[model samples]
Target chain A: MITFGKGNLRVPKWSKRVFMVAAGCSPFRKYFPEYKLEELVMMGYKMMLEDNNLKLSPLEIKDSIQFAVYGQFADHFQDQLLCEAKIHDYLGLDPLYNVGIKTGGATGGTSILMGAQAIASGYANCCLVAGWERMDEVDTRTGNFYISTAACKDFETRMGRIYSSYYAPMANRFAWAYGLSDQVRAKIAIKNRHYATMNPNAQQPGDHTEEEVLSSRMSAYPLRFLECCAMTAGSASVLLCDEEMAYKLSDHPVEVFICGGSHTLRVADRRPMDIPLLPNEKPGMYDEFLKKNPRWPGFESFLAARFAAYLIYRMAGIKEPIEELDLVELHDAFTISDVQTYGDIGLRPYGQEVDYVESGDAYYGGKCPSNLSGGLLGTMHAVGATGIWQAAEVFWQLQNRYDYIHGDPKWWKRAGKKKPKNWKSLQVKDPKQGLWVSHAGVGSHVTVGILRKAW
Target chain B: MAKPAYEKAITTKYIGTPLKLHDEKPAWVIESPRAMTHIHTYGLLTPFFEGLTKGKLMATKCVNPKCPQGSTWLPPRADCPDCYERMKWVKVPSVGTIYSFTLVDYAGIGIEMKTPYWQIDVAIKGVDTIFKGYLESGKPEIGMKVKAKFRTEKPTHTILDVCWVPA
Candidate 1:
């Protein structure tokens, strides 16, 4: 967290040891009928304290916290801007500084980055980053409207492009370019659900067969209902601290570093269209414009994610991500996004993600185990909390603290008679490094973070 | 067999018997009065809208000789994004091709169109930016020729004044 305060003061290079000491998540469900937003936040905070083995009371812990950051997707409650302040008061935390973040689905990861910056800049010894969304209370029609706020108001919204609709064209183009088959998409859906069954926190933690996924009602042309993320109610929190404080707090701290992030042009700006010429130009003006401004890779889709991943890999000193990183957790809002992201993140070549998916290299115990936490597909998508959940999963995996669930024949029977080929052990023997990527606002805002286990 | 402690607690709290499982629904439906309002001074885009009323599509072009971005923008901006200089409006040809499109299976809020409508990004002739609109008729296809069908009789002074049709 670089302190963008007065003078834009920079933290000393030596004090750049930011570590994730503790992480907690509320049980993901379709709806939290028993609790409200503030209560859910408090529950997550308490769980984080418990996970860190801090037996101190809420007030005691609050006094030690120097700063806090909160992330929420939509206003489940009436007060939108003051939600973070309300949560701070509800938790009885007297942090020196606190702020709220609303970056569509990327809020969780962005909040984590802010927390790390706060600790790294010596502004706070410990910072609490939390994200939650109570979406189940809203009807489908209302929810669609709120989610569409992430798109461009003047162009996308006015043109009647909703959240799912934005991805529809991307899916269409990808299928048209790569000849993406239904079998490949169904496989991706089944793989995520299969991993979800192993996760107790998963909202839809049941095995889904290929036939079930293929037969699911289509939401968009290429995206089906089962292939989409479930609207969920949950909260997640992570505690970040300086290097010295991290060692004193936890035996195994996952050292996290924000590699890089970028915001891309709007969908209208980068669409595959020729540049209009000036009135005076001759017949060769359009061709001249093309020469000066060649078409870029992001013109198709996932532009920001591609740009962010390139910077991240470069910052982490990783020349080859597929061979270097132990695991990756992507924001798979739609199954097509997962397929597109694999190539965007440089795990595989563009348009060759179908080969990677068909090869079973993305599953657990494969070449590159991705979304072992079931991703957004298997794990419930609380919108704002998803990015934080992805980071927490990496933290747990790095420390080997997560509950390891092996292949079970009984669970397979419940999801229909389909079993994964290599379900031997979903656990990574020793993961040194992992990456977490998330996006918001129609692929405009993207944030990628790299986590390395500090021995 | 005796009921589990957790089950007994839940049943006792609600009623003597266990609570019935049912599909979850919101307690109340909120009809939100949502409206997207923009106060445009028409500082630079006045002529662009005026062109639409006359059944003409227009864009802004940077007159600076050395300016990048090819001195052109669709849905024109006040200044050139690259050179940051004032731009002049120019008439764009109505005939274009579909750059990309999506069939809206579900209509969104504030959208007056019926379901199963075609929303397209039409690349106007000689224009760098794609103009977004719905096709007047016929299914959308990539690279398919399309021409602007403006509501010249009753101009709305909005982007909706024009629709795309097969050329």
Candidate 2:
């Protein structure tokens, strides 16, 4: 088990390497009314090029990353991989090794975690972790069509499954099984959107009311548009290097300590011992999979939070109830996801999330501040890049410079407190450890990483 | 242009003897490039919805059968993820009600259908039951009642062939 930290490094370090990075932002419904998947990929590439003079054609970039991670948004894995491979070639990074893709909705964070592990494990001296998706640009019908393919192609996609339909059953099960009220889920949306307002980069940033959430067009029963994650076109990338190299690359660097990752191919397949389900197993798994049985607290945010807690216990060597963590960044792919995430992290008791939101206890300075820098619900998914984006947010917060860079004055004003110099900067006065969690696959794959401030 | 003799009867036959046999194989093998509506395939990892031939949509149930109810998956699976045990194929009822829906006005790559298509959320029996498919009927309204139609053109029984129709 390799251990990592901020200073007194045990591992050999390189210089001027990426300590923290991500692709870019793309929030659908917020970025534009319509865009294509291909266009979104170009947008992310453009951002990468702006910072670095990596001269390469779209095709080159696609091909270069072919061996890399693939998201649900791509038309063909080969096409996306080759397109990225070409870009890497242009960037002058060759022989991208163990090229493979991992899928979890908002899976970008996990990719970064994997990339960080690869770097830490000495698989590669330096590696780029990227997540991109053209959600807005792609045909909604086609995009959802692909999502259908990802979820359960034959039954869902060929049967003409609606995009939100993929989550509805799960969402319903979350509500019913957890004994959660619809109103609580609505409040989750309100709170996350409010958090998004603090993020300038967010796709749909604004304050929302419970009424607005309830009134939003219903995507699925008990799940309004506000409660769901709006699709977007965006990408994120994080460049990782050895500890020594990361320190040398930039004066300000964020180190990653991977606690552990547990991703399940099928979420419903494994039931954790601690979490309880309301009803007993139904006769047919297919029937349960198809019906609107609600999975209580069924959201990406909650899963990320739970996984983070699990990681915290693993890293801290404590199995006590998870209320000790100070901060978190989860894949709030949807408002409901964020709401359930609150409870999943044990920040609030199940079904009491509305009270938590009403108390304003789930904010940056709350008992356990969640999605302080915005989330997929607020920032924009960028398809594959979501996980990495979540990781980057945590990195920014650890630096304690988020407010300074993003600048959400309203958050401070609402708290009736003085504003900090930088919200993205780490605020750990004598910090020792921090935790990060991200999940994809419609809340199927949950991973957690624990990081220390480094000696 | 002169109309062909089968113009009136030219509707796509989703259910038939040959179509039923088609469910045993992958759609790629049976579908003409023109008939191919999907651009990608997820293989066994995702539920194929091809099992409608046997009148069942398969799903993976959480094998920790000891855990609370509702931990199971639908469409049936080969193994239980929670217990890591073999899964049992369970048949589901075809009845469902609309949970949500959308009208897509654009087409995508590999999707030959024109815009203004109706996508629906049709409820299936059992916990957390719901599946998607083209709505071949009047404008979709919430609370609309529909039943699952098994398609035969599916190349395998594991493929999802059900479509929701007004009851």
Consecutive 10-residue window with the lowest summed lDDT within model 2 chain A: A273-282
lDDT of 2 by residue, B5-50 (tens): 8775565656743422222332221211213454655455344344
What docking grade does candidate 2 earn? incorrect
What lDDT is reached at residue A317 by model 2? 48
Best by TM-score: 1
Would you give the TM-score of chain B in model 1? 0.74
- Give the number of the best model, judged by lDDT: 1
DockQ of each: 0.19, 0.11
Candidate 2, residue A56: the lDDT equals 42
Instruction: State the displacement of the C-alpha of residue A251, model 1, in Å, after optimal TM-score superposition.
Output: 0.8
lDDT of each: 0.72, 0.51
lDDT of 2 by residue, A306-405 (tens): 5455444544443332345556676666555665555554555455555556676666566556666656666666667676667656655555555443
